[model samples]
Target chain A: MNEYFSDLFSGAKSLLVGLSVTIREMFKPVVTVQYPREKLEITPNFRGHTELVKDPETGTHKCISCMMCQKECPSDCIRVKGEKREGVKGLALVSYSLDFTKCSLCGTCVEVCPTAALEYSQEYELAGYSSDEFRFDLLKRLEER
Target chain B: MTPEAAKQDKHTFVLNMGPQHPSTHGVMRVILEMDGEHILEPEPVLGYGHRIQEKMGEARPWPGFMPNTSRMDYLSAMIYNHGYVSLIERMTGIEVPRRAEFIRVITDELNRIQSHLLWLGAFLLDLGAFTPIMYTFDDREQILDILEDVTGSRLTYCYHRVGGVARDIDEKFVERTRAFIARLRSRFKPIYYDLVTSNIIFIKRVKDVVSFTPELARRYGLTGPPLRSTGISYDIRKNEPYSIYPEFDFEVPVGTKGDCLEVYNIRVAEMEQSLRIIEQALDRLPEGPFRNKIPRKVKLPQGDATFSVETARGELTYYLVSDGSDVPYRLKIRVPSFSNLSVLQELCRNMLLSDLVMSLGTLDLVIPEIDR
Candidate 1:
C-alpha cells in the first residue's frame, strides 16, 4: 500500500513537471504569423528568382547576351537570344527567358555572369494561375522596371 | 483439432500502413501481416520519392549536382551539401580555406540541431502528443531564420560550393549564432527536459521497450544515434574526424540500453554537443577568403573518390567518378535511412502494432533519403 502511493506521487510529480513547461509557455507570445494576412520579413540573402540588372548610365540592360548564365545554369532553365546589331561590336540582347518551374535557385547563374548582369530579385510571392506565367522574359521585365 | 485444421482456422490479416499516412514521414508504404493488434511481419515498400538523382548527376556538370543533394534529405540539407562538395574537393585535391571549413562545421551542426528538434516533435506527435511539436516549431523557426540569413533557403539549402561555401559569413551571422546558442542553452534546454524527458507517460511508453542489443545493431549495420544507443559509441564525427570536428571538444553521449527511450535521450544529448561544436567553431573562426578561385567549368582528372559525413540521420556517403570531363562518369549516394529502415523487418516481428510506431519514430527514417 505504501509502494502504491509512492508510485502515484512520482507519477503526479512527473505529470506536474511536464505541465509546468506548457503552462509557462502559455504566457509566451505566439510564434505563428497569420499567413496571407501577414507575410514573413525576408532576409537580404533570400534568392527568389533571377533578374537582369539594368545599367543606370545606359538606361539599358547590362546583359551583353554573353550566354554565360545559360551555359552555367544546371537545370537548363535559361535561354538567351542575341543578335549583332548593324556596326555593333558585341551581341545585343533580344530576349532572355528563364523558366521558373525548372530553375533550382542554386545561384550559379548570378555567380558566373561576367558583366554582373544577373541578380536575384526578392519577389517571394511568385504564385500564378498558369505555368506560362512562370516563364519570365527578363529583358521585358527590365524594360518595365 | 488436428494440426492442419488448427492452422487453417488461424486468423491473420494484412494491413497497409502508408503511402499517404502522416506518420510515415513521406511516401512510404508498409505491408504488415497481423494477428489482431500484433504485427507478424512488416515489409517496407519504398521508391515513391525516387527521382533517379544518380542519372541526373551524369547529365549535369560537377557543380550542377549541388541542388539535388538537398532534396534527398531536406531536413539536414546543409550536411548533404557538405558531403557532396567535400567529395569533389577530395577528388580534385582542392584547398578549402580554414575559415570555410569552420563555417561548414558551424552550419552543419546548426542544421543537425534543427533536424533533431523536428524529430523530437514529430516523434511525440506520432505518440499522440500534439503540444510538444508547437514548442519545437517555435525553436525551429529561429534556426530557420538564422540559416536563411546566410544560406538563402530554409529547407532545401544548397549553400556549399565546390571548394567552399557560396557566401561568406559576416559579424552579424556570428553574433546571431552566439545569441541563439545562449537562448537555446538558457531557455530551451530545461523546457525540453521537463516537458518530454521527465514526463512519466513518455517514459512509460519508451523506456525498456523495443530495445536492440549491440550485436543486433552491428548485424544490421546501423549507424548514428540508433547505433550509439546500443553503447557502441561509433560516431563518424569522432571515429573518422572529418573536416573541423577534430578541433571541437564534445562527448559522444551513449545509452546503456538500446531502447526507444535511449534513442530519445541520445538525440537530446547530441543537440547539446552540437551547440558546443557551434560555439567552439564561432570562437575559432579565422579570417580568409571563403571560397577559392575555381573555374566555372570544373573539369576533373580521371579518378574516383568516396567521402562520407555524419549527417543528422546517419552516415551519408557520396562516391563520385570523374572521367576527365565536366560531368561525372558515375555518382552514387548511399543514404543512412536505407540501411536504418532495413532493421525494421527484424525489430518489429511479434511486437504490438502501436509499439511498431514507436520503433519507427525512434529510428528517424526520412523517406526521401531512403527512396533516393
Candidate 2:
C-alpha cells in the first residue's frame, strides 16, 4: 500500500512536469503565420517555375533557339520552335511553351541554357481550375511583362 | 495446423491497416491476423508509391537523374543527392572542391536533424500525442529556412552536382545556422526530455514493448537507429568513412535493449551528434572554389561501382553499371527502409495491437523510400 501511494505521487509529478512545458509554451508568441492574410518574405533563391529572360540590347528574349534546354530536359515538357530570317544571325525563337503540369521543377532547363534565357520565377501561390491553365508561352509572357 | 486452416480458425480474424491510414506514415498497407487485440501475423504490402525510379534512372542521362534521387526519399533529399553525386564522382574520377565537401557535410547533417525531428513528432503522434508535432514543426521551419537560403528549395532539393554543390553559403547563412544550433541545444532538455522522455505515460507505453533480440536485427539486416537500439553500433559514417566525415569527432549512440523507447532515445541522441558534426564542419569552412571544372559531357568506364552513405534513416547505397556511356546501363538503389520493414513479419507475431503500432512507428518507415 505504501509503495502504491509513492508510485501514484510520482506519476502525478511526471504528468504535471509534462503539462508545465506546454503551459510555458502557451505564453510564448505564436510561430506560425496566417497564410493568405500574412505572407513571409520569399527567399531570393526560391524556385517557382521557369520564365524567359529578356535581353536588354536586343529588346527580345536571349534565346538563340539552341534547343539545349529542350534536348536536356528529362521531363520532355518544353517545346521550342524557331525560324531563321535573312537579317538575323541565329535562329529566332518563334515559340517556346512549357507544359507546367508535367514539369518536375528540377531546374535542368535553367542550368543548361547557354544564352541565360531561362530563369526561375518567384510566383509561389500558383492555383488554377484546369491543368491547361498552367501551360505557359514564354514569348507571350515576355510580351505581357 | 496448415496456413490456410489457421485463417479459418474461429478465434482469429484479419485486420487491414493502412493503404490510407495516417499511422502508417505513407501509402503502406499491412494485413494483420488478429485474435482479438493480439496480433498473430503481419504482412506489409508495398509498391503503392512506386514510380519505377530505377527504370527512370536508366532512361535519363546520368546528370539528369539528379532530381529523381531527391524524389526517392524526400525527407532526407539532400543526403540522397550527396549519395548520387558521390557515386558519379567516384565513377568518373571527378574531384570535389574542399569547400563543397564541407558544405555538403553541413547541409547533410542539418537535413539529418530535420528528418529526425519530423520522425520524432510523427512517432509521438502515432503514440497519441498531438502537441509535440506543433513543437517539432516549429524547429523544422527554422532548418528549412536555413536550407532554402542556400539550396534554393524547401524540399526535394536538386542542389548537388557531380563535381560540387550548386551554390555557396554566405555570411548570413552561417550566422542563422549558428543561432539555430544554440536554440535547439538549449531546448533539448526542457522541451524533449522534460516533456516527453520523462513523462510516465510515454515511458510506460514504449518501454519493454515490442522488444527484439540482436539476432533478430542481424537476421533482418537492420540499420540506423533500429540497429543501434540493438547495440550493434554499425553506422556507415564510422564503419566506412566517406567524404569529410573522418575530419569530425563524434560518438555513435547505442542502446542496450532493442525496444521502442530505446529507439526513440537513440534518435534523440543522434540529433545531438548531428549538431556537433555541423558545428565542427562550419568551424573548418575552407577558402576555395565551391565547384571544380568538369567536362560538359560526362561518361563512366565500362565497370560497375557501389557507393554508400548514412542517411537519416539508415544506409543508402547506390550501385551503378556504366557501359562507357553518358547513360547508365543499370542502376540499383538499396534503401534502408526496405530491409527495416522486412522484420515486421516476424517481429509482430504474438504482440498486442497497440504495441504493434508503437513498434511500427519506432521503425521510422518512410514508405515511398521503400517502394522506390
Candidate 3:
C-alpha cells in the first residue's frame, strides 16, 4: 500500500512537470508559417519540373535537340523533335514537351544534357484542373519566361 | 490461429485492427484474436503498399533504378540512395573521391537523426502524448532544410550517383549544420529527457510491459533498436564498417532490457551518437571532386554482389545479380522492416490491446518498406 501511494504521488508530480514544460513552450515564438497568408523562401536548388534554359547572348532556347534527355528519361516523360533548318549551326529544336504527370523529377534529364540546356523550374505550387495542363511544352515555357 | 477458427471459441472473438488505422502508421491490417480486452493472437497482414519494387529494379538500367530506392524507405531516403549507389560502385570497381565519402557520411547521419526524431514523436503520440510530435516536427524541418539545400529534394532524394554525390556542400551548409547540432543538444535535456523520458507516466506505460530475451530477438532476426534494446551491440556501422565510418570514433548505444521504453531510449541515444558522427565529419570535410568520371552506360560485371547499410530503422541490404549487362539480371532487397514485423506474432501474444499498440509503435515500422 505504501509503495502504491508513493508511485501515485510520483506519477502526479511527473504529469505536472510535463504540463509545465508545455506551458513554457507555449510562450515561445510561433514557428509555423501560416499557409496562403504567408510563405517561406524556397531554396535555390529546389527540384521542380524540368524547364528549358535560355542562352544569355542569343535570348533563345539553348536546347540543341540532342535527344539525350528524352532517351535517358526512365519514365519516358520527355519528348523532343528537331529538323535541319537554314543558317543554323545545329539542328534547330522544333518541339520539347514534358509529360509532367509521369515525370519523377529525378533530374536525370538535366544531368544528361550535354549543353546544360535543361534546369529545374522554381514553379512548386503546381496545380492543374486537367491532365493536359501538366504536359509542359519546354520551348514555349522558356519563351514566356 | 486463423480468424475463422478463433470465432468458434465462445470466450474469444476476432477483431480486425486496421486496413486503415492511425496506430498502424500506414495501411497495415492486423487480425487479432481477442478474449475481451486481452489479445490471444495478432497476425499482421502486409502487401497493402507493395509496388512491385524488386521487379521494378530489374526492369530498369542500373543507374535508372536510383530514384526507386528512396521510395522503399521514404524516411531514410538518403541512406537508401547511398546504399544503391555503393552497390553499383563496388560491383563496377569504381573508386569514390575522399570528399564525397565524408559528405555521404554527414548527410546519412543527418538523415538518421531526422528519422529518429519523427519516430520519437509518433511513438509518443501512440501512447497518448500529443505535444512531443509538434516539437519533434519543428526540429525535423530544420534538418530537411539543410538537406534540401544540398540534395535539392526534401524527402525522396536521388542525390547520390554511381561514382559519388551529385553536388558538393558549401560553407553555408557547414555553418547551418553546426548551428542545428548545437540547438538540438541544448533541447535534448529539457525537452526530450526531462519532459518525456523521465516522466513517470511514460515510463510506467512502457517499462516491462512487453519484453523478450535476447535469444528470442535473435530468433526473429531483429536488427535495429528492437534488437539493440536486448543488450546486443550489433550496429552495422560499428561491427562492419563501411565508407568513412571506420575512421569515426563513436560507440554503439545498447540497452539493458528488451522493452518498449528501452527501445525508445535506444533511439534517442542513437540520435546523440549520430550527432557526434555528423560533427566529426563536418570538421574533417576534405577538398576534392564530389563526383568521378564514369561511363554513360554502366554495365555490371557477370557476378553477384551484396552491400548492406544501417538505415534509421535497421539494416538494409541490396543483393544484385548482374549478367554483364546494363540492366540487373536479378535484384533482391532484404529490408529490415520485414523481419522486424515478423516478430510481432510472438511479441504480442497474450498482451492487452493497448500494450499491443505500444509494442507495435516501438518497432518503429515504416509499412511501405515492410510491404516492399
Candidate 4:
C-alpha cells in the first residue's frame, strides 16, 4: 500500500511538469505563416530559376551564346542556338530556351557564365497548369525587360 | 487440400504496413507475419522511393552531381553535400581554405541538430503523442531560417562546392547562430527534458523495451546513435576524425541497456554536443577566401577515391572513380540507412506488434536513403 502511494505521487509530479511545458507554450505566439494570404519574405540568396540579364544600354542580352552554360548544365536543360552576325566576329544571342522542369537550380549556369549574363530570379510563386509554361524563352524574357 | 488452404496456417496471419502509411515516414512497405498482435517475422520491402541516383551520377560531370547528393538524405542534405565535395577534393588534393572548413563544420552541426529534432518529434508522434511535433517544428523553423540565409534552400541544400562553400558567411550569420544556440539552451532544452524525457507515460513505453546487445549491434553493422546506444562508443567523428572534428571537445554518450529510452537519451545528448561544436567553430572562425578558383571544367587524373562522413543518420560514404575525364567512370554511394534497416528483421522476431513500431521508430530509418 505504501509503494503504491509513492508510485502515484511520482506520476503526479511528472504530469505537472509536462503540463507546465504545454501551458507555457500556449502563451507563445503561433509560428505558422498563412500561405496564399501572406507570403514569406525570402532571403537574398534564394535561387528560384535561371534568367538572362538584359544589358540596359545595348537593349539586348549580355549572353554571347558561347554555350558555356549549356555545356556546364548537368540536366541538359539548356538549349542555346546562335550564329556569328554578318560583320561581327563573335556569336550573337538568338534563341535561348531553358526547360525549367529538368533544371535542378544548382547555380552552375550562373557561376560558369563568362559575360555574367545569367542570374537567378526571385520569383517563388511558380505554379501552372500546363507543362509548356515551364519551358522558358529566357532571351524573350530579357527582351521584355 | 488446395494450395491456398495449405499455405494458410491456423494461428499465424499476415499484415502489411505501408508504402503509404504515415508511420513509415517515407514509402516503405513492411510485410509482417503475426500471431495475433505478436510479430513472428518482419520483412521490409524497399525500392518504392528509388530513383537510381548512382546511375544518374555517371551521366553528369563532377560538379553537376552536387544536386543529386542532397536528395539521398533530405533531412541532413548538407552533410551529404559535404561528403560528395570532400570526396572529389580528396582525390584531386584540392586545398580548402580554413574559413571554408569552419563554415562546413558549423552548418553540418546545425543540420545535425535539426535532423535530431525532427526525429524526436516524429518518434513521439509514432507513439501517439501529437503536440510535441509542433514544438519541434517551431525550433526547426529557426534552424531553417538561419541555414536558408546562406545555403539558399531549406530542405535539400546544395551548399558545399569542390574547394569551398558556394558563398561566405558574414557577421550577421555568426551573430544569429550564437543567438539560436542561446535560445535552444535556455528555452528548448529544459522543456524537452521536463515534458517528454521525464514523463511517466513516455518512460513506461520506452524504458527496458526492445533492447539490443553490443554483439547484436556489431553483427548487424549499425552505426551512429543506434550503435552507440549499445555502448560501442564508435563514432566516426571520434574514431576516425575527419575535417575539424578533432579540435572540438565533446563526449560520446553511450547506453548500457541499449533500449528505446537509451536511443532517445543518446540523440538528445548528441544535439547538445552539436551545439557545442557549433559554438566552438563560430568562436575560432578564421578570415580567408571562402572559395578557391577551380577550373570552369573540372578534370581529374585517373584514380579512384573513397570518402566517408558521419551524417545524422549514420556513415555516408562516396566512392568515385575518375577515368581522366570530366564525368566519373563509376560512382558508388554506401548509404547508412541500407545497413540500419537490415537489422529490423532480427530485431522484430517474436515481439509485440506495438513494440515493433517502437523499435522501428527508434532505429530512425529514412527510406529514400535506403532505397537509393
Q: Write the per-residue lDDT of candidate 3 for residues A1-145, one digit (tens) a residue.
A: 9999999999999989888889989999999999889999999999999888888999998888889998899888999999999998788999999999998889999999999998888878989799999999988888898
Name the weakest run of 10 consecutive residues (lDDT summed) in model 2 chain A. A54-63
Give one digit per residue, the lDDT tens place, for model 4 in B1-372. Answer: 332333365567789999898888999999988777777779999999999899999987788889999899998899999999999988888889989999999999999999999999999999998988888888888999999999888888899999999999999999999999998888555688888998987998899888788998889888888899988998878988888899999888888889999999999999999999999999899998998988666787798999999999788889988899978999999988888888999988878888888887898989899998
Q: Weakest 10 consecutive residues, lDDT, candidate 3 chain A?
A: A119-128
Judging by DockQ against the true structure, name the best candidate.
Answer: 3
Native-to-model Cα distance after best TM-score fit, residue A54 in candidate 1, in Å: 2.3
Q: How many backbone collisions does model 1 have?
A: 0
lDDT of each: 0.89, 0.91, 0.91, 0.88
* Residues B171-242, model 2: lDDT tens digits: 999999999999999999999899999988789889998766789988989988999998899999999989
Task: Name the regions of candidate 2 deviating beyond 4 angstroms.
Answer: B1-9
C-alpha DockQ for predicted model 2: 0.78
Q: Give one clash count per candidate, in the order shown.
A: 0, 0, 0, 0
Give the alpha carbon lDDT tens digit for every residue of B216-291 in model 1.
Answer: 8889889889999999988889888789888889999998899999999999999999999999889889999999
Q: Candidate 4's residue-wise lDDT over A1-145, tens digit each?
A: 9988988898899889888899988888877989999888899888889898877887677888899999888888999999878976589878999999998888888988998998889898889999999999998888787
Taking the candidates in order, what DockQ does each have? 0.78, 0.78, 0.81, 0.73
Chain B TM-score per candidate, please. Answer: 0.97, 0.97, 0.97, 0.96
